[model samples]
Target chain A: MSKVMVVTSGKGGVGKTTSCASLGAALAQAGRNVVVVDFDVGLRNLDLVMGAERRVVFDLVNVVQGDAKLPQALIRDKRIDTLSLLPASQTRDKDALTEEGVGRVIDELREKFDWIVCDSPAGIDKGATLAMRFADLAVVVANPEVSSVRDSDRIIGLLDSKTRRAESGEAMEKHLLLTRLDAARAARGEMMKVEDVLEVLAIPLLGTVAESPDVLTASNLGCPITLHSPTSPAARAYTAAARKLLGETVTVTPAREKRGFMSLLFGKKAVLQ
Target chain B: MSILNFFSRNRSAPVARERLQLLLAHERTLAGKSDLVALLQREVLGVIARHIAIDPDKVIVKLDETGHVSTLEIDIEVPEGALARG
Candidate 1:
């Protein structure tokens, strides 16, 4: 059965798009059929991040407006054959996306793919709510910061209350994807430690993506770090996160501290090294 | 500067408390001292109100943030004669 996973964080710039692209590609690379859908509307960026902007002749809005068929709007990755993208329209307003319209698209996607990864826009708005309405699981992407963790807490509360499964009193599998962790910084007590964030959020850890230029380098190339810079630390982090999401057990290493004992106490996150 | 920089917008700052302060501010403007003091006072008053009849206007709440060593100081003025019997 297909699983709908919404990558959301009420706070912005927490690498939601990057995680979506990387996780989707990683899962597809693992031979699973995955479709990453951009739900950001107006600001549609997943295509830009995925390096498929120019190839997008139609998008989610086009499909919803009945201007194009689903398959017509679906763009198969030229590089990763198993992965595909359902881009969002840069012209349509967020209001143009209806609950029923999105539901239909997700249902169709569910019938065809193993995973439908939705890249949600930031904040607790209609777009964000709808993007997560049908998610069977969620990746609450958060940066190792107090504000991000707090906002993620709000998003997590919504995931447990606003989702269909939640509405029906069913538990939705949720995971935490803590990104942009700087070991030296975290160790120095400069950044919110993973343990602190985990204690506050109280969710199972998936994997941690360090703050690294390889992420920017891959973004410039419009590819996932896993694809553009597979050997980089950030890429390995995303790959491990992807593996964990697929029900595999993987231990996440703690980032070293530059000024503190994050590394000494928790140990360097073995996978990052 | 390491101690003072905590809670700044600068990403180079070192101190989890500073990061926490900066992050809390990002989510809401009311996280500042004055705003938080007022909020804390209101909550404290409500809690005290449930237990006894007292004048809330005399309630005092102080949050001292000195180099990340924060301590909450609160004083709730009991209605003039309420404490006399106790």
Candidate 2:
């Protein structure tokens, strides 16, 4: 059966687009037909993250407005054959996205793909609500911080009350994707621990991506980290998350802290090594 | 700064977590009813003021929830001997 997932966070810049791209690529690499739809409307960035910005001839607005068809707007990823992207229009605002039109697009997408990943816009607005309207599952992305966790809680409230599944009295499965976690900082009491975030959000954890330069490198290359640097810490975390999403029981490991030369020489654990 | 203050400042995560818990609890209780809460506070204060000399600024009306149960909490401060005047 096909599943629709929304990658969202009420707070902005918490790696929603990054999670959407990486998870979509990871699932496609696992041989699942995945289409990631960007729902950010005027502030579209998913196409750039997927490295298909130049190929965006028609966008989601075009399809919803009936100016173009679904197939015509979907940009197939050049590297991943099973992966495709439906970019949002930068020229149109969120008001251009009508609920009825978005519902029609999502219904058509359900018949064609194994997984439909929607990259929701930030904030609780029409765009965000529409993105999650047809979702069976939600990946609430957040950083291990006060603002991010608090905003994620608000998003969770909306996910439980505003979505179509919620309105129909069906439970919407929610998972927390805690990204940009610096293990060393978290240990030093500078950032929230994984357990603390989970306790507050009260959702099952999907996975945690470490704070690493590799993420920026992948974004710069316009390729999903899973494909750009498969062995990198962030990529491994995302791949494990994708596996868990597919109902596989995979043990999630914390992102390894990069040891500096001084720590490597003088750290107590280093002596044993 | 004193050493104790320095140590207290080091653990910011716990402080953030505690604040978020309180904030989320307050926000969740008032979700979709902030306007109603404000109106209720004003109307309840009005009725109370008609019978007692109370400071409107000091009065607080809020909804607090523990687990599944929600309670409407009202705290009013009246000056001493105001009951005799009323």
Q: In lDDT terms, which candidate is top? A: 2
TM per model? Answer: 0.74, 0.84
Candidate 2 on B34-56: residue-level lDDT in tens? 77778988998899888987888
Interface RMSD for each predicted structure: 7.2, 3.7
lDDT of 1 by residue, B1-86 (tens): 34444435343323554555555444333232566798889988998888778777889888666565768899876766776766
lDDT of each: 0.82, 0.89
lDDT, candidate 1, at A245: 83
Residue B83, model 2: lDDT of 80
lDDT of 1 at A36: 98
For each candidate, report its DockQ versus the true two-chain complex.
Answer: 0.09, 0.41
Output candidate 1 Cα RMSD: 9.5
Error of 2 at A111 (Å): 0.9
